[model samples]
Target: MTRPTHLRIHQFAGLQPGPRLLVTSAVHGNEVHGTKAMAEIARQLDAGQLTLRRGTLTFVPIVNPLAHQLDRREGDRNLNRNLRPPVIAQDFEDRIARVLCPLIAQHDGILDLHSFQSAGQAFAMIGPRNNTGELEPFAQEATESALAGRLGVSRIVEGWLSTYALGLQRRQQRQSDGSRRAQLISDPHYGVGTTEYMRSTGGWAITLECGQHLDPNGPEVARLAILRTLVFLGMLDDAAVEPHRPAQPPEVLQLYDVIDREDMGDSFEHAWASFDAIKRGQQIGTRASGEAVLAPSEGRIVFPNVKSQPGTEWFYLARPSDRVLG
Candidate 1:
């Protein structure tokens, strides 16, 4: 069966029925690698360079076209954050979510392509490990992590939604006035992204950050990730993709907390990059009140954003995990 391409979505289905997979890119307007890679894959399919072996593969090259049109991270709001269909469609991103959320829910699995603002090696972010808790009841961690390890990246990060939930809780306690809260989406699960939303609908997903936004190697990284995932999922033939093996076993990191900027004057101790290691008691930054912000433990910093507004996450802290990847 053929579905006509619309809303920047390209669908290719095999004659034999199999798993349905979704691949999305440019959920953040400024992330171009995914879009570039998607275009290449589409071109290959059109030119008969690659063929869908046994499944339906869908690609949304520009999930947030308004943001992509402006060449910015967002047009009105971050589409990647607070990702769910809005009842009223309040903002530009909300409208995109209305269309995107259902597309995500129907897939068996997904690989959301993204690029970060900071300098860092390409890594994959998986959802939390399964527990009895209701906040994030995920039983697909093992399945997701195994797929992540084969994505040509040597690092995997989890605990993103859990860490952000803690940050939101801490922010609410410190903030007396609701002024700062108005600046962000009001959802308690504000950290729910493409992958999280997919997990909620009983589909496993992975967010593959393919390197810095403008990294010269970004497109290739994204392209390889797509191909590797298709082959690993048995949707494409292994001969269609290059053999990928990291130099060592991938390092799994558990993000424990987010450090929010308290005031406009707060700043970091140095020019920090993503995955920079921190030692206990080392001053990582200075608070607005003139006190040094010291590391609570020996770990690594992730997603250090100098331009974050007050009461928003400035950086994240993570420690090594003992997760055994399949």
Candidate 2:
């Protein structure tokens, strides 16, 4: 069957009225595992094998259909960035955002499924707490954090907005120092993705990174995550659907900084994989001037992009944090 040109939403309403939970996949077209998982969930729902006991479960399997059709990350722009409603739609993604932002406002919770460029264990990206700036209006800080803990992932990352802001600030500083001018700030709102946009509208959202984009296991991980989220929200009977649990305790990571590529001469010492441990003072890469870029502290690297464009984020550095949901 041929797919529609625009976004497609699949709604599974339950018998009881409760919170609305939204699940979005394929915001980045190349990350297709979530789309597969959503399709499977829809199949089970249609086949009567899966049931929603309370609340509504809505799925957007392909938010960026154009990108999916092209098998690229984006059509005209990255749909994940600057998710706020625009005064005027600028591109294909912006036009979709104009329609999507209002729909997201109606949800109480969201799970945006995605996969990263590197092969690694699944992780959940948790937005800032309720009292934190844009999230202040949403008084469900504790609830959101607790929901992330229930995701059954081995790692939970926090402080995405702050880290992103820091990266932008660093880029601006580099531009002032005679480095090649970086791309002008396109997302001044600093809203990173679907999760951030949902959170801004007083809904709790989490970005679940299933695994490497091309890995067959990615879809399975995404499927389990959706099931676990349903159980966490009490939409599915716990006895009927057992959530996936890790063999060990999950490690919490707090993002502190982002490393952006400053110049064309900047490059990595080796093909560094995501989650690779870096000891304090270890040389991670080289600058445009051939100066070794050393690790500021002991931490594991996340989202290391060896082929990242100049003046864009090459990787992120994160360390263990004591924050946990009670």
Candidate 3:
């Protein structure tokens, strides 16, 4: 089995006990903005400008260094999927995810870093609000009241990690004591599929999509998000946050399906950025054969593909609802 590797950094201020935060970045190596945000936050905090009112903070930047080094997805596959470990293949992402999930579970709170292919707006992701039952560790601040009051996101979306963890818990409950307990399942929040595995074990986690990939402003937005989280978790005082518009609900939805298109032979005409609405029966794209692909329902595009792989997502159409959000 391939052993997992990770990097960690910490900052502390004052004698009081505060919320412990695990801030991670670069699960997807291309998502460098989050890593930069981590550095920036560390710099500001260590400078003592952004003092921790009550908690410890840890950051793991460049979680998938090999993928970042290659500038390609892990082993030519998307690192965001299939995060089972014990390293049967001894590859990069698997080892990294295996190591990171446990570390995230150790903290009182977590904020994994990420970025999108298209232009993105910063937002806090609250996993489908209801199932905080299994992931009580992560859900300490996941209630609708806390999100609305602190993070300012009223609409709660189902997270891929929350779904997988809850499912495992239910399955394990059905199993006899003699049956082996199920191991963790990795998920989207971390570059590993196993974030869900940690969630199933009652861990806390959140994936923060800072902004557009490679955009000049991406890092700054990520940096701001981290600071905001610190404040929301009571790490910093309100003075750190500049007065801004409250975060509107993000269509509160689940990831009902992800349509992974195979190859560039299929072309999508026109621009379809994230949050752009699509109507039912609208022509979203076309195949090389000129066959039409239509929207199944009236919904908005969550993650559209300008860059994609053959047999991978060209983009995903998200149905805004609890049942479909995960």
TM-score of each: 0.94, 0.91, 0.76
By summed lDDT, which 10 consecutive residues of candidate 2 come out lowest?
177-186
Compute the lDDT for candidate 1.
Answer: 0.86
Model 3: per-residue Cα lDDT over 1-326, one tens digit each = 33334445555644678777777776676788878777777787779777777867777787777767766445434556555554464455556656765666667666676777776565455444444353434443343235333443333344554444443344344433342111222222222343444455454556666667877877876676677777777778979976335555345666554554544777766777776778989888887678888888887766788677543456666666643222
Candidate 2 segments exceeding 4 Å error: 1-5, 132-138, 174-187
In order, what lDDT does every prediction score? 0.86, 0.80, 0.60
**Model 2 TM-score, all chains together:** 0.91
lDDT of 2: 0.80
Better of 1 and 2 by TM-score: 1
Which model is ahead, 2 or 3, in terms of lDDT?
A: 2
Residue 308 displacement in candidate 1 (angstroms)? 1.3
* TM-score of candidate 1 relative to the true fold: 0.94
Residue-level error in angstroms, candidate 1, position 175: 3.2
Which residue ranges in model 1 land beyond 4 Å of their true spot?
A: 1-6, 176-186
The clash count of every prediction, one per candidate, is 0, 0, 25
Task: Give the per-residue lDDT digits (tens) of candidate 1, residues 1-326.
Answer: 23222368899989999989999998888898988999999999889999889989999998888877788787677777688888887777877888889998889999999998889999999987877688888788778978998899989998888888888888767635554245464458688888889999988999999999999999999999999999988888899998688789899999999988889899999989899999999999999899999999999999998888776789999999887888
